[model samples]
Structure formats: C-alpha cells, structure tokens
Target: MSIRHGLLALLERGPRYGYQLRTEFESRTGSTWPLNVGQVYTTVARLERDGLVVPAGEDEAGHALYAITEDGRDELRRWFTTPVDRASPPRDELAIKLAMAVGTPDVDVRAVIQAQRAHTIQAMQDYTRLKAQALEAAAARPGVFDPDDVAWQLVLDQMIFQAEAEARWLDHCETRLVRLAPQAVADRREGADNPPSDGDGTAEQADGAPQRSPARVGGLRGALRRPRR
Candidate 1:
C-alpha cells in the first residue's frame, strides 16, 4: 500500500518517468490500486528532495526521468523489510457509550444491557434485508466484469456476518445479566438479613443477627476479587 516505496522499487530496476511507472504499476496490479500521473510525479519529487532519487536525463519534452540512487535502493530495501504499522481502526462510539452505561452510578445496568440487545436485533434485521438484496444482485450478474459488483456481494456478506455475531453476543450478555440480577440486588440489600461484622461472619447486624454473602465455591468464576466501588 506504500505507493511511494513501490515507485522507488520500480525505478531501481531502471530509469523511468511518471507516465511509464504509472502505466506499469496499474497493469501489474490488474488496476487494483490505481496510480495517477500526478501521484507518481509527486512521489518522484519527494524522493529527489530526500536524495533517494535523482534526475537521470530528459525526454524530448524535457520531462524528467528519475533513477534510483544507491541511497534510494537502500531505502527501497528497508521499506520492503520494515513493517508499516497500519493505523488503528476508528473508535465505535456505540461501544464507548455502552461501557459508560455499565459503569455509571444510578444507571440500571440490566436495562442498559437490554437496550443493547434490542439495538443488535434491529441491526440484524437491517443486515438481513441487505443480505437478501446482495443475493439477488449477485444472482443477476452473469460474470465478474465489474469488480465493484463482485465486491458488493462480499460487503453484504461481511455486514451480515457482523450483524448476526453482534446479535448472538448481545443475547448471551442479556441472558447472563438476567440470571445475575437477583444476586446483585441481594448483595446490595441493607438488612433483610443480618450483616457481617468480623473478617469472618462472626459479629451481628444492627438487627442483632449475623448476615453475610453466601459462602460457596462460586465455580470457576469467583476466586478473583473485584475492587471496592
């Protein structure tokens, strides 16, 4: 995806101007990532400014042809070997708001979870509509002459996959939260039962009886301690 580096590499093979490099790069890639003449010229200028490439000669119109210098070849090699860190994907604002809802005081976490489940179900409905549309469109197409049409099917497939996945995950979250709601309420209740006073549950509540959370293995889920709110 580094057009700059790719251009330098092509020049390393031989001196070539913008037009030739642009044509060749496009033909080689089956026009996957189209290169414009202006882009090629701009990249060449930057390389020249960086001392990575120099003007080899000129054609009849005095159009500059560039050749990769030793430094340019070195840079091209480094580019081939060095990793380019792709930019992290954009934030999902919905996910951020959901996390906030989970942590916010006075918020009913169960209600928030239900809302998320509903939202995901709505998304699944929308995606299902689009999925049907894509299937119809693909069936209508006889061949892959238009790459855009080909890609449209894949886009719809991906959207469908993601929507269904979100719905399933949301359903799981809702179900688990429903099961845990009574436990959470009971833990917070002030005094239907006695309250613990000692490190062990030895001391009595203000009602003159000891109360504490039930002692259990709590399966694989609860040796870890949550921090005090």
Candidate 2:
C-alpha cells in the first residue's frame, strides 16, 4: 500500500487535518490498514515537502489542515490509472516456510500444509459470515448507499477469494507430494546402491572396476520440475 498516495487521495476530497485524514482513511478502507496519528502527520509533512500538499488555514479546533495541490491531483490520477506491478511479487512468508520445511530433515511438510489450509479455511468462513451480515444490514434499509459498507465488503471479498486460492494451492501441493513419494523412495535406494566415492572420486564395484558415483536425486527442484501425473 502506498501511504503517500492514499493520503493524497483523501486530501483530494478537501482540506483535512492529520487526525481527520487518519479517521477517514480507516473509514474508507474498513480499518483494513489502520494509521497512527504520528504516521499520518509524518506522511502529511512529507507530502508538503514534496510539493504535493500545502498547508491550509487551521481548522476551527486549531488543527493544522492540508490541501492537495495540482501536482498531488496529477499523482493521484496516475496512480488510479496505472496497473499495480506484480512482476516481482512480495515475499509470502507461508510459501517461504513451506519451501524450507520441504527440504528440512525431520520436518513434517504435510502437517505444515494442513495447518495452513485449516487456518485459511477458517478465515474464509469468517469473511463469508461478515459478508452475510453486511448484506443483511444493507437489505434492512433498501435504496440506501453506504460507501463504508461497500468498501468493507470489497475488502472482505478480496480476503475470502485469496483464502480460497490459498486453500486450493495447498491441496495441490499435498497431492504433488504424495505423487512424488514413490520417486523419492526410489532415489533413496539408488543412492544407497551407489555410495559416495572413496577419496579418489571413484567407487569400486565387486569386479574391482572403478565407477563414477551416480548423481543424487529427490531434490526439491527435481520434484517440482517433474511432469504432473
């Protein structure tokens, strides 16, 4: 999330103090990304320094207000028009953890995947319940347009969809692991049959003929690259 752009967007509405901006931002985003007062003030100061915002007259309560400049409007417009870059995605902690767990000795990779699946499912259920409640509330008052409720429902929908995708991915991972199990066992046996070289980079057969050690198998990359059954 671009806090700078977010603040500029709110300022585009009208002049607002740091506190007011913080409150409104949370309201618009359904508190998905809460802002601290200090963070709001800091971002506002940066915006002022960058010529994106300028100080407006103080509010009646003596709160220093800021208004977006033309430059800020231009920036906000560009942000709205530009597609968010996903060529290099943010690192996902669960993905990293699972990758590591797959390679680590004594780690239960299936258990890790199962735990994450359960958590994701639970979150999806919670979001679904929240969506149901929001719809019910909206139904109670027909023809009413609540921007806050709409914003919150959008956020909830995104979360639920992400959770659903994650659950499916986990299931795929588990199936892949199961399919690779036989290959993994075969690789282990092959490795046992062709032990490492004895100091000379060569192993001796029963006939005393030297043989090159077979390359190790069952690596994570190899498993991933194998064609799906």
Pairs of colliding residues, candidate 1: 194-211
Which candidate achieves the best TM-score against the true structure?
Answer: 2
Per-residue CA lDDT of candidate 2, range 28-136, in tens? 7878899999999999888899899999999889988899999999989999999986644578999999989988999989999999999999999998998899889
Residue-level lDDT tens digits of model 1 in 1-229: 3788878878977989889999867654445479889988988899899999999899788877899999998988888888764333346765667678765788876677678778877877886786677568767877646544555556556666876777676677668778987887787685457555545444555566555553333421242343344
Model 1 earns a TM-score of 0.44
Clashing pairs in 2: none
Instruction: Quote the lDDT for 45 in model 2.
Output: 89
What lDDT does candidate 1 reach at residue 224?
33
The Cα error of candidate 2 at residue 65, in Å, is 0.6
Residue 5 alpha-carbon offset, candidate 1, angstroms: 13
What C-alpha lDDT, on a 0 to 100 scale, does residue 217 get in candidate 2? Answer: 43
Instruction: Give the runs in model 1 whose Cα sits over 4 Å from its true position.
Output: 1-92, 190-229
Cα lDDT for residue 142, candidate 2: 97
